[model samples]
Target: MGLTLQFIPYLEIEGLSSIGRIRKLLNAVKENKIVLLEGRLRKEEETELIKTTMEEINSEFKGIELAVIYPESQNMAFFRKAKQHFINMLLGDRQGLTIVGPASVVKEIKKDPNKIQLFTTDVKVKAKRPSKKKKNKG
Candidate 1:
């Protein structure tokens, strides 16, 4: 006999709306599965997720937990670093695990090198396609 495991990846859908994605994400969580969310939820979506999770949270199902990754700069320019910081402050950074289940499903989600030493999933930001180029075409 052999143990079986499954991985379900939820990437951005071409025709699916934000609400649709949230609905699917919540549904998957309800099924007690680890979801590798492609992107971070919007501010409103995060709030809704927390609210919905809170309602169903119990002894068996803990709830949703977001594990973010913050990259450390190495010999970076002061102005560039400051600009990056300002941008992050305005539009929150979404660079890590958005686990929405019990600890049994996702025990430790880490991205920092220090945490990775203990063994964990190293999630990185998936590069976004340039949207500015589309405007230029118009």
Candidate 2:
């Protein structure tokens, strides 16, 4: 199966309740699409998402791989860090990226303070064997 990526802007989920956000993200992963959310989920929401995913796991759905990439405030200068905090306080969780994908396709998600690497399973395609024709002996 081909991989699909869905990019969701923060405005798309800005008004959704925590449960609603979780449902939307899970539904996309269930459909085999990797979700690229513009912002990270809250701590409680992240916990709830994992809990809900665990509950919904089945034979067909193996669950999900989630990763978040955000700027490290400690590495920033004090003034910049303070500014970031103020911005976050006013703008909500709009300072980072969130990635969610189905475990069936996504093998692993490696994240560092500044980077993310997504490894996937290669979907093997079967090749058809060519048939040989017999020559007539005259």
Candidate 3:
């Protein structure tokens, strides 16, 4: 089966921010059998919201997987500490994954890529492992 991914953009304080988006996203994940979350949480409140949401989801769907993406340039100490708490709260008994990249990269992806697409004929490709061949002996 293909990997199921749920995208949650960074939280903003304005109306209909990422936190609300996350609640809907999580519900969709539960319904669609999503196994991964590719998104960002910019604020401490966002993190707390995630923890609470995960707990709520877990009560119904135990061992649900979550994959989060964050910026690498963030304060490592703070991220590390928060990550520990996040894991213990949301992922302690469940299998999950996390990825880190530059903030710019995440921002770029979070933006509307259609505005920058060079070609309309671009085709998306799926990742695959290279095949190995046997060597011949002389």
* Candidate 2 colliding pairs, count: 0
- The top-ranked prediction according to TM-score is 2
Of 1 and 2, the candidate ranking higher by TM-score:
2
Pick by TM-score: 2 or 3, better one? 2
- Clashes per candidate, residues 3 or more apart or on different chains: 0, 0, 0
The C-alpha stretches of model 3 lying farther than 4 A from their native spots are 1-3, 6-15, 35-39, 54-59, 74-138
Instruction: Give the per-residue lDDT digits (tens) of candidate 3, residues 16-75.
Output: 455664555555555543423333344564465558555764444532333344344344
TM-score of each: 0.46, 0.89, 0.34
Residue pairs clashing in model 3 are none
Better of 1 and 3 by lDDT: 1
TM-score of 3: 0.34
Model 2 CA lDDT for position 50:
93
Candidate 1 wrong stretches, greater than 4 Å = 1-15, 58-60, 70-97, 107-138
Best by lDDT: 2
lDDT of 1 by residue, 1-138 (tens): 221222334345324566676667767765655555643566687787777777877887777544433355556699978887686566544434354543435555555644542222334558897666544554
Identify the runs in model 2 with alpha carbons over 4 angstroms from their true place: 130-138
